[model samples]
Each structure stands twice: as structure tokens, then as C-alpha cells.
Target: MRKRERLELIKKLILEHKISTQQELLDILENAGQTLTQATISRDMNEIGIIKIPGPDGSYIYGLSKDKLRQEGHRIDETPSILAVSPLVDGLEKMIHVDVVPGTSRLIKRQLLTKYKEMIFSLIADDDSLLLVAKTDFYQQVIRQKLESMVVSDEQ
Candidate 1:
């Protein structure tokens, strides 16, 4: 699997289970038909900002970093905001196109997915742009407004 796919799977597993060890994560991935090494998993975890937080049972388990949880009112990292470069949001129907700073599209895509999961059907990020497919044209407009509002809030 690709690194992005593996990262998404790791996030899913971490969210669904109280995984506390690299070995356990490795085993789960293996069972899921993914052949990965401990080192690769370690790197993926760090890349995605996964950390060990207290689970319900008082033991530590893998979880997303609070800094990465934008939906929970946490401030995202100091990368440029979605409108920092004046992202061009254009759409014909259910698809919206956004121009982003080079190398920041993936981060923007992740935040958008987290904050607007129900509205987004699929999101693709390239080096300097994002293509977001919403459930409908109305949802696409909502996403566009939200992106603009992010810049407004950031400016205030």
C-alpha cells in the first residue's frame, strides 16, 4: 500500500482500537494483509502526529495529537491558512477546485476532511491544489464559504 493509504489505515486502527504497542499495530496490519515493518509504522505514526494518550482503562493508547484535532477547537500548526494564498474556489457541479501553497495541500485536505467529513465525498491533494468532491453543489458552496471564513477568522 502507498504511504498515504497506510497512514489512513493506521489512523483508523488507532481510532477504533486501544493499540499501545508497535508490535500490536504491526500484527493488526499484517492481519489486514499489509506487510509493514516496525520502523515503517513508527515513521508513519510520527508523520501523522500520533501520540500515546490515556485510554478509558487508565492505560496509554495511540491517538491523534491534540494539535492535529482542528475540529475540537485546537489551533492547527502554523502552516498557511487555506486562504493565505487566496485559494481559488471554482466548481461546475459537485467538484470544487482550490489553489493552495505548494506542499501544503495534503495538510489542508486532512483538516478539511476532519472538519467537514459529512459534506465531503472525496478530496484529492496535489503539490499546489486540491480537488474536493462534495455530496452536492450546495455542499460545495458550503465548503467554499467555510474556507473563506477560516481566513476571516485568522485575520481578526
Candidate 2:
């Protein structure tokens, strides 16, 4: 299937069912006669700005951004904070993992690119999340704090 079609199916599945993981989504697609891999689904989710929201039972389920849902009057149950996803800090590797709301990653990346062009070694994005590799611990701290503040401000 084309990326657009695949993304539409994903959105439909999420709206119709509580899809919690990439594997579950893949299974659903396969049962519907579409063959796809977990990685493909992940990339598609990223492309379409899908993020995981906390489900009623505590597990996370795929959700559209508030910007998309507002017009439809579907309320998102939880408001995510920057720390809700838990940043994974790897001191040994000088890398930090940050989970952001979809669409926000691109904004964050653009801002970081302009501000930390020299200190950041690399920035990788996947769905509503990103990994930042810094040239030093100082850079990592700076980037992490700035990102956290940005996310919080956006949520407000």
C-alpha cells in the first residue's frame, strides 16, 4: 500500500480500536489483507503525527494530535508533560531520549538546529520522539532542559 493509504488505515484503526503497540497495528493490517512490517508502521505513524496517549487502564494507545481531534470534538483524556514519557539519559554515550507529541519534533529539531548547531553531534527523530547525541555532557544538559521547557510551554 502507499504511505498515505497505510497512514489512513492506521488512523482508522486507532479511532475504531485501542491500538497499543506497533505489533498490534501490524496484525490488524495483515488481517485486513494489507501486508506491512512493524518498522513500516512505526515510520508511518511518525509521518502522520500519531502519538501514544495513556489509556484508561494505564497502557498507552495511539491517539491523534489535539489539533486534529479538536474539530471532531473527541477529547484527549490526558495532557502530556515533557517528562511524561521519561527521558532516557545515557551518560556513558552522552545521548538523551525524549518523547514528544507528534508535529512538535519537527519544531524542536528546527529550533535546536539554529541554536545548537555546533554542540549537537546528531538528532534522530522517530514518530513523536527524538534522540539527541551531544558533543559533550554540557550540551546534553542544555538541550534537554531547553526541550523540556519548550514542551511544557507548548502544552500550556
Best by TM-score: 2
> How much is the lDDT of residue 25 in candidate 2?
86
lDDT of each residue in 31-108, candidate 1, tens digit only = 999989888998898788676655689777777765666645656555443543244445457777776644456667
Per-candidate TM-score against the hidden true structure: 0.46, 0.55
List residue ranges in candidate 1 displaced over 4 A: 71-156
Worst 10 residues of 1 by lDDT: 79-88
RMSD (Cα, Å) for all candidates, in order, is 11.1, 6.1
TM-score of candidate 2 versus the correct structure, residues matched by position? 0.55
* Model 2 spans > 4 angstroms off: 65-80, 84-119, 124-145, 148-156
Model 1 quality (TM-score): 0.46
The lDDT of each candidate is 0.74, 0.71
* Prediction-by-prediction clash tally: 0, 0
Clashing pairs in 1: none
